[model samples]
Target: MTTYLKDLTQSIGYLEAQVVSLLGAKNLASMRGKGKLNMLYDP
Candidate 1:
């Protein structure tokens, strides 16, 4: 279970990075402000 969670977290981080690169920081911040982001992945 620990390994699974670690892999999942890593995957989520990678995906989030991709989204940030595609959307840019300003767009990401706007989405966060609108409460569109999940709290677990806030960082």
Candidate 2:
């Protein structure tokens, strides 16, 4: 029972990290897209 609980906790932490990184990647992509649009309009 104790080992199972430990494993569950670790799994949750790993999942949280994955979600954070995925969100970061999405934000980066959106920012890059906006930058490209700005460049297109500015020049």
Candidate 3:
């Protein structure tokens, strides 16, 4: 029972990290686009 709990916790942690990494990459891409737009519009 204890080993199973440990495995479950580890799996959950791994999933959380993957989600965070994916979100970070998506946000970075969005920011990159905004930066390009700013450069194009600046006088």
Candidate 2 local Cα displacement, residue 30, angstroms: 0.4
Q: Could you give candidate 1's per-residue lDDT for residues 1-43 as a string of tens digits?
A: 9999999999999999998798887767776787854655666
Model 2 Cα lDDT, one tens digit per residue, 1-43? 9999999999999999999999989877877878876645553
**Clashes (candidate 3):** 0
TM-score of each: 0.55, 0.67, 0.77
Best of the two (2, 3) by TM-score: 3
Report model 1's TM-score to 2 decimal places.
0.55
C-alpha local distance difference test of each model: 0.82, 0.86, 0.87
Error of 2 at 11 (Å): 0.4
RMSD of each: 9.8, 6.2, 5.9
Model 3 score (lDDT): 0.87
- Model 1 lowest lDDT segment of ten: 34-43
Cα lDDT of model 3 by residue, 1-43, tens digit: 9999999999999999999999989877877878876645555
